[model samples]
Target: MRGIIDLNSDELPKIQDKNGALKRPPAGKAAVENLKIDAAILRQSLVAQAGAEIIIYKDPTEAVSTGVLGDVVMMSKQSYFETFEAAPFALVADGGEVTVTPLPINRAAIHVDATGGLQTASGIYGLRFEFSRATLKSYPSIEDAIMHAVVQGLARTGDAVLTAGIMAATPAAFSLAAAAAAGVRMSELRGLVGTAGHGAAIDNNGVLRAAGIAAELSPDLSATIVGSFARSAVMIRSDVEVVVDRTNIDGSLAVTAWAGLQALLPDTTRFWTVAA
Candidate 1:
């Protein structure tokens, strides 16, 4: 296992045998495979999900990122809900001349009338992160941290806005919690299929399939009420701006990004808000 050292070369990695050559190891103890360099290190991937988005109005393209910050997209303040009614047929007696009733399958649709009008995605919402130069060097994936911060901050802010809007619009009698209920049911919310649970547990907000109203926890609403809502209830987003400062007054690298976010409810009535 002992071999001559290639000490003459200036490179630390180069074999430094007295002859300036890296001596190859035998296929045993000092073998190159012993390092297992191929699988020695890896960085984890981080992702974030926003419940607010589940109930918000969105275009198909909004989900795909072009590797660019994005551009302004005009969205409508109004949407429509359409549904079909299934009719039942009676089994007619042996039909020689039985007058069979024609099934009348009626159709119904409603204009959601999102009344706020087209909103400007001009509201600024963002966050700044700073790390000392040395700290950034030592820590891995600050990029992921930055992206996650933006998403979570945005989500929390949007939820607060949407919940506040609904609360403000609801009559005082129903807005404030007189007492906590066992749970809010889809039937209670008028067939809306959703649940809001957070500050409280399922005891207050029962479990349901991930549909109806806001399918996920309404970050702010969970504390007071639990109900599902129509999907076209909210709208969100806009352009992004990122600023990086390596030359800091305190020698820390600072990262900052986009603002100009919009959280608008077309029709608050489309939402079901009640005391928990």
Candidate 2:
């Protein structure tokens, strides 16, 4: 195999432009690793089309909770109690005082510990690609092939996990078989109940900016498909950083992409499945 390129050491060299001054990173700046892959490369997944949030903490060791930390506001009176059933209430005569239970309007509650299956279990999925040093040099660019390969894997498994989480969150699958032609408001369905602040906690999910509800196809569930799940139903968290491992004698390389994924469906009422 042609000589392996060790970007950290071999690829970079020292050079001076007349003044004898170093043209390298100044002070505390670290040279670019050029190893990490952009998440955008594989945006053709169900999670991506579903308006899922991708959380990426800056500090690798910044430390984060396993479960999602979020809150939900009581949209209706039923939302305040354990048995959440939408029932009708009669109006009393004007000024006719009657004894009735106190109300908790727009009650806001926090969920650190998951109640029921509203939050899915957190699992770290790894996508790895191992190739010979000669194979890497053969690509138009090493990062491109690795990024595309690993992300495609992510999108596939990510769907299984996402579908599983939603199925577990609710008793039955949220179907959109008989919905409007235009589909429903993406956020309305997966808002996870009302959020005065919880929305901001998870990057407002991509739905906050997502143009419209997309649909799900047999293969790719991206911005193009007749998308469904159509809003922020699932969340994917990862630094999107690539970890490089060197093979001993073979001089091959393994590029890996890591992510912590979870399905959050506190209240799936607002969501509707879309099929196009």
Model 2 segments beyond 4 Å from truth?
Answer: 1-43, 47-90, 96-120, 151-157, 170-215, 219-231, 269-276
TM-score for each predicted model, relative to the true structure: 0.43, 0.45
Question: Which digits, one per residue and each the tens of the lDDT, describe model 2 over residues 1-276?
Answer: 222222112222222335555444322323343222224312445455556543322212222345366443322111110112233466789898755654522221212122221123456676667889788777534564444455456556666665555444443223444234234444433322111221112234443311233223333222122223433333444334467888757788876666655554444443332222
The window of 10 residues in a row where model 2 has the poorest summed lDDT is 74-83
Per lDDT, the best of the predicted structures is: 2
Task: For candidate 1, write residues 1-276 as lDDT tens digits.
Answer: 112111111111221234544354312223223222111110010001221232222222223234367654433343323222234555666755656555433221122223322233325555677789788877555554454345445445555555665566672322213212313344534211114442322333664322222233433444343332332223332333577777576668877765433434443433443433
lDDT of the candidates, in the order given: 0.37, 0.40
Clashing pairs in 2: 188-270, 189-270, 189-271, 214-227, 215-226, 215-227, 215-228, 216-227
